[model samples]
Target: MNEENTFETHRPRLFGLSYRLLGSRSDAEDVVQDAWLRWQQADHASIRDPEAWLVTAATRLGIDRLRAARVQRGRYVGPWLPEPAEIDEAPGPDHHAERAEQVSLAFLAVLERLGPEERAAYLLKEAFDYEYAQIAPLLGQSEANCRQMVHRARERVQAARPRFEVEPERHRKLLERFMHAASRGDQTAITALLREDARLVSDGGGKALAVIRPLLGRERIARLFWAAYRRRDPAIEWRMGMVNGEPAILRYRTGKLAAVMVATTDGERIVELLNVANPDKLGAGVTPDPGRASW
Candidate 1:
């Protein structure tokens, strides 16, 4: 196969690696585009493994972007959350249970706590199934050091991992009930669906109106949601769908995408709620008119 075709074959994998590393679709796309440019300029005849080379290049670029992103996020106006990306349910080589879990907002949130190198090491080893020996050269670190980084990253991630696994159907049911209560401004019903220590964070990117800080405790969160829906435009609509392998609610205002909401549950109740209202981050699967009433 020619170099262009070979690069096209591995584009999805490269984008996946970059997206997981940076947690931003725009940055991932830039990284993959830059990798393609590098691939074109290099002497492909001398390279033994094109896929590995492309992956390494994309990963390094993602790491660099992530490092710079941390500084920008620090100055962000409100609580920062990863942009929600729509998941394709079609049967594909990359569609699997493990990949779904790794791409989840809950998982990515935990990854954000780790340093850039640690995040890279963990994703390469756990998500992509890369060996320490293989990852060492990419990170320019000793195999032993890569192992240590993965170990540390794993421990930190495990510490914050979900306490219980809710079946997909049950999770959707719980979210629906929570949304129903919020839509009706039922504080009692909403509070019943939230864990006592539940937290709600909204990301408006300073362009939209949202909570400046995270709302803690079930009562406070319930009240916030109740008040929020009460103030929303009555013409707006809510649609339930999957985002990042989990159930989510998409809000539409005048047939335009307004916000995306995803929650992390502890089997019976929601422990965390993430509301993404940032216009810049609402690109995936969102159109001027979604057409359907609901998913």
Candidate 2:
């Protein structure tokens, strides 16, 4: 295949890798574009594997961006959540269960805790199934060192991972009930749907109204939602959709993106609620139809 066709063929995977590593669509796109420019200027005739070369370039770029982002986010207003990406309605090779799990907001949030090199090693090893030996060269480390990094990153991620695994349908049902309760300002109903220790985080980027810290406990979360409902805008429309392969509520104000709310459930109840209201992070354009009450 020609260089142009080869680059186009691997664009999605490159973007996926970069997005997972950076947790920002814009940054991921920029990394991919940079890789493209590098590719254009390189002597492709001497390269044996274009995919591997592109992946290495993009991943390195993403790692650099992640390091900068960590510092930038420290000054961010309110809790910061990964920007949501809309998955296709029909599952494709790129939107399979494994890929979805890797890109899930919950997974991305946990990933944020790892150092950039550790995160890169973990993603290359676990998400992309790259061997330790293969990852070592990309990260400029020995194979054993790469293994150690992956091991450490795995322990950290597992510790913060969700405790329960709820089926997709059940998760959606729980979200529906939680949304219904929140919409009606039914504190009792909402509290019943949340775990006693459930936490709610909102990211407003200092440009909008959001709690400066995570709201802990079911009571606090329910009260916050109740207050929001009381002051809810009539023009804002809430629709059920999929975000990061899980059920989410997309709130639109007069047809413009307002907020994207995603929940982490443990089959029976929600343990965490992430509300992304930052206008800067809400431009991915993931809109799904308003499905019926029943799945």
Candidate 3:
């Protein structure tokens, strides 16, 4: 295959790497596009490994974008969420379960605590299965330094990662019950399904109405959901689907997508709820219309 075809072959992995590092589909796309441009301009004849060259280029671009994004996110209103994306269930034979889990909102949230280089090193080693030797030059560090970055990032991510259910069916059932309870303003039932320390976070990007800070406690979360549904337009609809490899509730207002919600549970009860209401972030993974759905 030619250079264009070769780049096309690696686009998915390139996008995946950038997305995991940056946690924003648009930003990831920008990084991948930038990598493609660089690839076009580079003398491919001298490159022994096109994939490695592309991976290094994309990884560096992601690190720079993420650094800039951290600054902007600091000024963002409310909790910032990774833009949710529709996962392709069959992403070819190269897809790894570990990589799939890394795309989760819960996992991505943990990654936010990591610095740019640390995040890239950790992902390259863990998610992409790159060796320390391979990851060293990718981040412009020594192999030992890359290993240290991955080690530090791993500790932080593991400590902060929420314990979400691994079974998809059980997760879906739990969400269904929560949705049913919230739809009817059944705060008692809602509270019953939550862990005592359950937290609700929304990303409104200051463009939509959302809780400025994380709402904690089962009681508070229950009440917030109860009040939120009660105040919403009667015509708005809830559609259940999978997002970022987990079950999600997609809200629609007048047939337009409004928000996407996904909960992280410990099999028995939900420990965290993430709602993304930012319009700009909604365009990536979710379908605009998923037909009518009910709890």
Alpha-carbon error at 288 in model 1, in Å?
A: 8.7
TM-score per prediction, in order, is 0.92, 0.92, 0.92
Residues 1-295 of candidate 2: C-alpha lDDT, one tens digit per residue: 8889999999999998998898888888889999999999989989998988999999898998899999999998878888876633323334323336788888888899999999999999998999887899999999999999999998999899845766777887899888888888899999999999999888899987899898999999999889988996798677666677777777777776678788888889999998889988876645433442312
Please estimate how well model 1 matches the true structure, expressed as its whole-model Cα lDDT. Answer: 0.83
Cα lDDT tens digits for candidate 3, 1-295: 8989999999999999999999899999999999999999999999999999999999988988998999999899888999876733223334333326788877788899999999999999999999988988777899989988888998888788745545777777899798888877789999999999998999999898899999999999888878977886787777666678667777777766778888888889998898889999876665433233521
Q: In order, what lDDT does every prediction score?
A: 0.83, 0.84, 0.83
The 10-residue segment with the lowest total lDDT in model 3: 88-97
Model 3 CA RMSD to the hidden true structure, in angstroms: 3.9
Which scores better on lDDT, 1 or 2?
A: 2
Model 1, 57-174: lDDT tens per residue?
9988888999999999999999888876563322233433333778887677778899998999999999999999899999999999999999999999989775566777778789
Candidate 3 structure lDDT: 0.83
Least well predicted 10-residue stretch by lDDT in candidate 1: 88-97
